[model samples]
Target: LTVTMRQRPSFVVVGEVRGAEAFTVFQAMSIGRYVFATFHADDIETFIHRMESKPINIPRNLMLTLDVVIILSNLSSDRGSLRRIKTVSEITGQDQLTSEIVVNNAFTWNSVTDTNPYSGFSYVLKRIAEKEGKFEADLEKEVDIRSKILDKMIEKQITNYKEFYNLVNLFYKDRVRLFETLDMTEEVLM
Candidate 1:
């Protein structure tokens, strides 16, 4: 896979580089290909701390593979405004240690204080409910159930990695055809 990518460089977006995929991802980036990837890095310290922790398991040899490390924070600004970003970072693997990554603040977002009664997160689900299809109602029901479950989870304390991992592994029922059915991809991971 790495050789094939090197032979034909292409833009790749990885959802998360949490496991052994980190090695190949690093090699591909080092070899020159436009790659945009994000792990659970919320801050530089968090990123550094995490690289030194488990689940990330980034090999020491492949540590400085990224050309950029964009950090996202959900912190509210001092001005009582919510902040979101399409931030940018330039990764320099020059110095081994004591090298601080540079971040360029590209954009900021305003907070939504008042609720517009017309808005909700279940728009897609609502549309699916209205649509006439074999699993249309099932999709809507699933979305609603998921939303409720997520809300309940959010109300509770932080979820452990094992719990989330179990959820992911369990949710991926018949993943072999899930992608093909969505017309996203026909290839199976395994």
Candidate 2:
């Protein structure tokens, strides 16, 4: 991780975080580098416990540098097995009195509905809005637009990774042209 950080990359990704390596991951995050790593834990509570305990021992204060945790779960049902995102949680801060990490769950899986539903609040989006000097509503609108584009891609069976990547890049470079090619209108973004 130290060697890679020297390159000053925009973000760092670790396939899996285990043992003392988690310290380096948190250190990278402490320095304002975005870090994406998978840690094996049954749930958010377990994740926090493990990280705070021996082997990992991430300091409570340093934990503030961590932004989000996404949990994926595998479920078996009548329709066979499916892997789905179980939770999307944001680390807001530490409790002032107890010094415990405060997490806000922005999205959670609904097994009954077999869908991930937004919790109607997101500190992460609020932070992004503040950083970008935009209203939270504006960011929400952008999310809606992007969601529509992704849905359109799935509907059209454009599942190839390369194709999806190029199309997403095109959306950033020539949004109007991409919308036209996708038979969509900017009005839909409203």
Candidate 3:
């Protein structure tokens, strides 16, 4: 971890955060480096409890640096076993009185519909909007547009990572052209 930090990378990824490594991960996040790591926990509450106790013992104050937590779960169904994102939660802050981490679930999966619906307001999105000098509504529109593009990709069976990466880059380079090619329109924003 120290060697990687010396290289000054923009992002750091750990397969799984366990034991003392959690400290270093939080340290990297504290210094503004985006750290992505998978931790074993059934839910956000359990995750917090575990982190604040035992061998990990991550300080509750340090947990404030975490921006988001995406929980994935595997489920078995008539269609067989599949993995789905259970929740996408943003760590808003720590409660002043209780000192407990405040998390906002931006998206959550509905088992009945098998869809991950956006829960409306998102502190993470708001922060991003402020940083980019754009309205939160504009960012929401962008997310909707991108979601449509991804749906189109899935329909066309563009599952390969390289293909998805290249097409996403193209969208970034010329969004109008990409929309035209995908038979989509900016009308969704309206």
Candidate 4:
């Protein structure tokens, strides 16, 4: 399966990383391919440790290619059960002396503030900005705008997959049209 996947250029989605296939995922990521995958672990640190140990045994340096780690947790409240992204961390690099991977906290949800504040800086974003010849701050602002577009979609209950996909594409093609279609104001997003 890995051989077949490598033949073509595409995004790879591994349902779970439990065996030697984990090596393939890491290799794909290192080669500038996007991979979406899920693995069970208590937290980000545990996830990295698990991947570096036992059946997976992924090397530390190769792990640096993993740009983002999004942690989703279920929270029980008075209203009902809520599933939210607890944190978004970026793999900065590995410490040469300690041989430990460095993680940068890019975004975290604050219960007190009831908001997710982004640091506007991450290793991956810096690379992307450099490649695109734009400042990291510009890329960060684009991310903020896109996030607001998604929020508007969910708030409006536009749940269908096709509808959501089209909306996002529309946003890229014509930002003004997207705002008009969603009945959203740029001021609110700002």
The candidates, ranked best first by TM-score, are 3, 2, 4, 1
lDDT per residue for candidate 3 within 1-190, as digits (tens), equals 8789889999998998878888888889999999989999988888888888889999987888999999999999999999999999999998889877999999999999998999989999999999999999989988988889988887888989998888899898998777777776655435
Give Cα distance to truth, residue 178, candidate 3, Å.
1.8
Q: What TM-score, to 2 decimals, does candidate 3 have?
A: 0.94
Candidate 2 lDDT by residue in tens digits, 89-186: 99998898988889999999998997777888899999999999999988887887887888788789998999999999999999998888788886
Every candidate's lDDT: 0.52, 0.88, 0.89, 0.83
Compose the digit string of candidate 1's lDDT tens values, residues 42-144: 6565775577467666654455565456566566556675435423343334354745433333222223542112122333344446764536557745555
Q: How much is 187 displaced in model 2, in angstroms?
A: 6.9
lDDT (10s digit) by residue, model 4, range 1-190: 4875658667887787788888888889888788898887767898899999998999987888899988878888776997777788898888989988889888888877657788766788898998999998888878877878888887999999999889879977988888889887654357
Best by lDDT: 3
Instruction: Give per-residue lDDT, candidate 3, residue 161.
Output: 97
Question: Where is model 1 more than 4 Å wrong at Cα?
Answer: 1-7, 75-83, 94-190
**TM-score computed on alpha carbons, candidate 2:** 0.93
Question: Model 4 off-target regions past 4 Å?
Answer: 188-190
Using all chains and alpha carbons, the TM-scores for the candidates as numbered come to 0.41, 0.93, 0.94, 0.90
Candidate 3 segments whose C-alpha is farther than 4 A from its true place: 186-190
On TM-score, the stronger of 2 and 3 is 3
Q: After superposition, how far is residue 177 of candidate 3 from its true place, in Å?
A: 2.5
When 1 and 2 are scored with TM-score, the better candidate is 2
Report the poorest 10 consecutive residues by lDDT, candidate 3: 181-190
